[model samples]
Target: MRLINLKPSRTNQLILALLPFLALLLAYALGSTARLAENPSDKLLPALSSIADAVNRLAFVPDPRTGEYLLWSDTLASLGRLCSALGISTLIALVFGMVVGMFPYARALLAPFFAAVSMVPPLALLPILFIVMGLGETSKITLIVIGVAPIMIRDLALKVMELPREQTVKAETLGGNSWQIALRVVLPQILPRLLTCLRLQLGPAWLFLIAAEAISADSGLGYRIFLVRRYLSMDVIFPYVIWITLLAVLTNVLIDLVRIRVFPWSELDKAS
Candidate 1:
């Protein structure tokens, strides 16, 4: 039987867009049941509601210690460390991936190795990475690189090489040199797709940063999670989980702005 291609219906469109919301709703419902299973007396919604009130105590309620509200400093410090690791990931991914993608032989040699390595849990390498780089900024930043760079470089390289050969031949025929062909023609075509790649990579890189910080750092979001566990402070760590998600959203939106600006042609095609 032959399958016919058709556009999505209104219901499908609505469901696709609302999919994440639906899944989260389902998860929360199931999670609430699971919590009740663990301890029947602990009603999930009321407990969450109580925690919400307690968070307000940071400003509204007085602290028992100095009679002042407990303002959070750990959150800010954790965010700073996250930003540092993220910065390292972006720079390394772009430079390393860009070069590898543009060169065929280099891509051939390194692409498979990277793909295989990426499949291995990046966290699994933390012990060795720590041993080699130490438990300072080096180990954490190095972990981010190992996690992000391989995939980024591979995608960027493939996208660059994916340009229509006819365009390259056309440019060469018009007296454009190798460098000129790459810069004027190849760069623009690939840059749009690369922007998409960059946006996608940002989330994963930041995710890895959290684990990297958690494993060894004395500070950062990961460190705060550890501290919270030590103190049985669940609420403090939970809010930062929300913060990480919000940061990813904001970063993706920023990249989306660049996509609109730098790749008007791609946007136009998408519109069509």
Candidate 2:
């Protein structure tokens, strides 16, 4: 009965995890009901059925203008841009991050430049991106890359620098040159860190993607959300926002699985 080690059972942990979300839903439902009771045409807080119907329409029904379900189309478009940008960012971070972190010359040359670039607010460059890259997919993807890559680089670089110097010295003693040491030693150690960096960057990457899509894009989750805002379609907007959150959560989970499966040592090292 001591308070020092009061760990909840798994069942209790599950309930605790779900409690806040359940409370939020109940609060929203009550508020929606109260609002609807006062004004039948309230769009600010649509009823549950309204949200369900909006989800059905967007997800199940094909758009009249285009022969595609709007929800699926928007999800696909957004996922495509997000995945492409993240893939590119991962490669860039792995290469440049390793180089910058491992080599004093590279760090001296690129670290300050990247540091300055990272300071420039990614959103502020949206106008310039749109102008230079045109109102196309390139701009949206580029926006995400610019938003997340520098920070990813910095993080991975720091991770590399944090590696025990003894490992590098030992590798050198084994006749490994700079290139061989980076590829054989630093690369393996930083792979897990790169994944960690990507997981951390997902939120900002989504933000940049959404902003670019909201400002100028034919179709995306953000574009759809902003599009419905003109008509005050809370039902559509709410479901879309939930969908985006779910996607982000699922992606992070997948990344976690990959880290655990592919780099099991990373977790064990941390635990030890």
Candidate 3:
């Protein structure tokens, strides 16, 4: 059999998917054991047990000062900022992307400006945003939008431009006006790609959110991580990092499921 034709069975695929994570856990355990054996006071590479203890303290136990579960509070704050920014980004992308892709005059007017804006580093603008918007949720959410929206706009615009020209012509032949063609044709075709562009922006959105939170915020996963670094609290930091990863993964899965459920034809397009 050709090498490319040798596909794994479902069981084998599941095992293959798990192997890397298992190896990573095993390596961390061994490293933690070795480090602790040499120095019981080691702060780095904390034992798995210590990580579990930190998770319990942060997640299950209420904070003495605030009387709230720290992990849950931080998660909520971070997610609130993330979701708000992403929602704004999606709306901006959809509106501007369609205008640019469908109308030549709009494309000529705005495309170059957005391209230039996208090139500027979003983090560099963080200080400016804080100075202008102040160190509040607004600044943090704005930072995420600035970092993610332009790229999404460009991606969705390009996807719109790539759509078959024939379809537009056919719609016009059916006596559809500009708005009617856009509503009945371009909008439906680009929606799946919009979700896809949003998916691709998730990692960058998280990065921008974390950066903004680390620099200025009262509560968030990123803020907590930076707050503990002063004491070299690896156990807390490691678990928080893992929790963030799990949250991002869960969100990605949910978005994919929505895309599949709402736009089953997108999957068929891919298969063809």
Please list the C-alpha lDDT of all candidates, in the order they appear.
0.70, 0.95, 0.93
How many clashes in each structure? 3, 0, 0
lDDT of 3 by residue, 16-47 (tens): 99999999999999999999999999999999
Stretches of candidate 2 above 4 Å error? 1-4
lDDT of 1 by residue, 1-272 (tens): 33566667999999898999889867866776678668866633324544566567654577676575433544465556556766665566555565566666867887788778767777889899989988887777777767776677678767766777788789989999866876787777776776787777787777777777777775566676766677555555555566667778897898889888978899998789
Query: Which residue ranges in model 1 land beyond 4 Å of their true spot?
Result: 1-46, 57-84, 116-120
Q: For residue 194, what is the lDDT in candidate 1?
A: 68
Screening candidate 2 with a backbone cut-off below 3 angstroms (N, C-alpha, C), the clashing residue pairs are none
The alpha-carbon lDDT assigned to residue 222 of candidate 3 equals: 98
Which residue pairs in candidate 3 have backbone atoms (N, alpha carbon, C) closer than 3 angstroms, thus clashing? Answer: none
Residue-level lDDT of model 2, residues 1-272, one tens digit each, is 89988999999999999999999999999999999999999999999999999999999999998989999999999999999999999999999999899999999999999999989899999999989989999999999999999999999989999999999999999999999999899999999989888999999999999999999888999999999899999999999999999999999999989998999999999999
TM-score between candidate 1 and the true structure: 0.72
Against the hidden true structure, what lDDT does model 3 obtain? 0.93
Can you give the lDDT of residue 4 in candidate 2? 84
By lDDT, is 1 or 3 better? 3
